[model samples]
Target: MVSSDESLPQRLPPIDRALDRYPYCIVWTPIPVLTWIFPFIGHMGICMSNGVIRDFAGPYLVTEDNMAFGRPTRYLRLNPKNVDGGSSAWDEGVSKASVLYGTRMHNIFCDNCHSHVATALCNMHYENRTSWNMIILCFWMFVCGKYVNVCGFVKSWLPFLIFISIVVLMAVYF
Candidate 1:
């Protein structure tokens, strides 16, 4: 019998292929429409803005990737067997990174330390509070398959059209 795991990767839908090969085919892209329709998706941008909370989740994926490169030999692989009661082999590094992330943030910003919240050491903490920017960034990030803000350039009636359509649909259904 053919195993399910063996066929997983082969069935992965290639979204980027069309985007890179034919940029004009963007109208057919399901990604942007999904992002616009889903409000929770934008929450990621909102989440990254608060570094203090994010620190609780351990180093962001970028930081982990950079550190991984420096310790290439120490990297561990995921095992299907780890689904049981025992801890996985990779837990140690992840645990350490979590503590380090929280300590690093708290030591610098416990009290009313406005400066700490604004800038981490020298790097500026992302305070993605502006509603307009958040929506714009979320849209483009969704479209480009990466994080970036691009709503400033869009001031057309497209958003109005979407909102109107949603309201009308709700009215008709309800």
Candidate 2:
């Protein structure tokens, strides 16, 4: 006879433990063409326990693939507090949201991969739902270097910088 603790896997990191207990995981990987110009423009997905990733691949297609945008560079835990408790309730919620978005049309600026992940997390009632917005903003700051010292500067000027860069790049190449 073995103790309950002995039966469970040992020495896992907090995030790893969370992944094992949670129904879904958020993952990030670089978008091929976009990463060439802006390394920060990456794709986000909700990875189920079976290693199937649900992501917005393109318009009218929410895909479940092993390698959505190559291998994932990062895995973000959905809810850290729920790591020990282990709830299955959110699983159906996330799955329903995924199917809903999967059938809808995709939009680059508005309804893209990050939005898909965000919506899933939101359905799960995850607290830190602003992560998607932060990811985009941080990447824009990284690429444009709009605000080196001030957060306010980035908040104020990053949009204009992004707009200018897009217009300039479009004019030059297309």
Candidate 3:
């Protein structure tokens, strides 16, 4: 007899780093001075089912594929299966959020990149929840995100490390 699990869809497409494609994922990149001082803070974007990225880069600008800050150093791959309509629903959610955000002003405190990602997740109703927010998204990404590679890992943390080191040396010396 065939197993019930056999009817379920297979895994999502693989991430292609060279192409900056991360299907069904939330991608993150560190901001220059902000992330160096506070490692948990960074820019975020959501990927379409086909791995294309959509992010609120600035006021009324929702860019595709080209992230505002730079490439993603960490990512949290989400399962399309979690959505009611799977991949198509995931793409629609990202699209809808991008369009909506494109008309809104970008506020570093409230409406920002993290807010954009949260809106997409809420639109998709991932995990049957619609309470996604910047704080929640930020916390989850910081705790669960995986570095794209060794270089990605260094890019995310090295600057923060150097900043801390300098602070410690200054305290000891002067």
Candidate 4:
């Protein structure tokens, strides 16, 4: 028997990298030196129903379609059906969180990009949970996120791999 829930995936819009549109996705990008050392760490953002990205860029700043680090190298697409109001609720959650973060100060350890994304998910009560945080989000993205493409895979891990190799070589020599 076919279920209505089973047809959700067919209704999602295709991702368009050229246009920088990723509907219902949590996007990620490397943070230069930081991400080069720890590949799991990076900037993150949430997207609207139309796929426009929204991120807490800095203190009192929330950017649209302008990720703080760069274009997203990876993304974790989410199911809107999990939201109470579906697409509209998802958009509202992202918008609410972006606005809230716009008035706050950026903190690397506490309140930052990841927090912004989490707030959105919490607002939408995603997966029936409001406990989203940096650790959970980071872990999920690292485990489940998909590379935008081949270039994305390289961009995300190449620097870390090179850094590790150089360190190993230095240790051997010294």
Candidate 5:
């Protein structure tokens, strides 16, 4: 038989172990200001201003580091067969790479586009460049874990983008 650890799925978190364990609470990501989902400014706090974790049950939010919150991703439930307790170093790395690649790809070509500027968001979901490498290791709720605003509150930041751009363009032209 394969060792439990070896059998583990490389990229997916052990939701079974999570559910088998403790009571989860909500906390904000350290760079909360960078993420619209997080209401509190920094560090995991008593309340998650708009944390995605604040909305769930089984996928309880567990505070890991001074700056991280943990929860399994919806990918586990949505695609259970893929959940194997195997080596995830490869998979996790790829996902991170995919995110970075997607962000870079999106930004390089679209940053100047109105929709992109209108959103007025940082390049990607992540911030705090220094802590980036450790972000995957940090036990934290997946952005799509318990909550998925899909731009619920963040969308509000859009209208102003158009307003600001128009003013800037006027200044440049006239």
Candidate 6:
């Protein structure tokens, strides 16, 4: 006779189990309803264990939500091991940093959501501030308005459009 336990099917582990290796991660998501105007300008948040995400959703508000951006398109690890202190100490430092900026004003050019995550990561003093620079570059690109369309030609391709316009004017006049 077959044993009862052998008749049962094996249960699979949770899909998020793979994420355990990354205790902290940067989550990215497309801008809702404004993807056309800002295709590359997406939202960013810090992902904690068990799918919790901390993000500066708006002015004076930092929220922790589950799967905050409806499943992040990417996960950028902050390299906790690189912190001057141990992992636990680093975690505490990040937590304290988050609390400090939790009620900060959100600004596009200055203190935005990306800044929130970057500040938290930087609190560990890991000596890698690339993420902060990346955020600033992304913000600048968004403000400059990069695109490939007629309406955005001036804002997106200002230098090229100006040069072409000048050439056309010279040809028409002389």
Best by TM-score: 3
Q: Write the per-residue lDDT of candidate 5 for residues 56-163, one digit (tens) a residue.
A: 111222222222323321211222232232123222322333233334322212221112211211122222122322233223334433321335233323444555
82-168 in candidate 3: lDDT tens per residue? 999988899999999999999999999999999999999999999999999999999899999999999999999999999999999
- Where is model 5 more than 4 Å wrong at Cα? 4-6, 10-147, 153-157
> How well is each residue in 57-165 modelled by candidate 2, as lDDT tens digits?
8876777764366555555544434433234534554577688886888787888777776666555555534344435533543444322124423433455567679
Candidates' lDDT values, in order? 0.27, 0.56, 0.94, 0.94, 0.28, 0.56
Model 2 regions more than 4 Å off: 1-23, 80-86, 128-174
Window of ten residues with lowest summed lDDT in model 6: 12-21
lDDT of 4 by residue, 144-163 (tens): 99999999999999999999
| TM-scores for candidates 1 onward, in order | 0.19, 0.56, 0.95, 0.94, 0.22, 0.56
Error of 5 at 81 (Å): 18
Model 1, residue 145: distance off in Å is 16
Clashing pairs in 2: none
**Over the stretch 134-159, how does candidate 6's per-residue lDDT look in tens digits?**
45535644454223234333333344
Off by over 4 Å in 3: 1-9
Kindly give the number of clashing pairs for every candidate.
2, 0, 0, 0, 16, 0
Deviation in Å, model 5, residue 53 alpha carbon? 5.7
In model 2, the worst 10-residue window by lDDT is 13-22
Question: Local error of candidate 3 at 134, Å?
Answer: 0.6
Greater lDDT among 1 and 4 belongs to: 4
* Candidate 1 runs further than 4 Å off: 1-88, 106-174
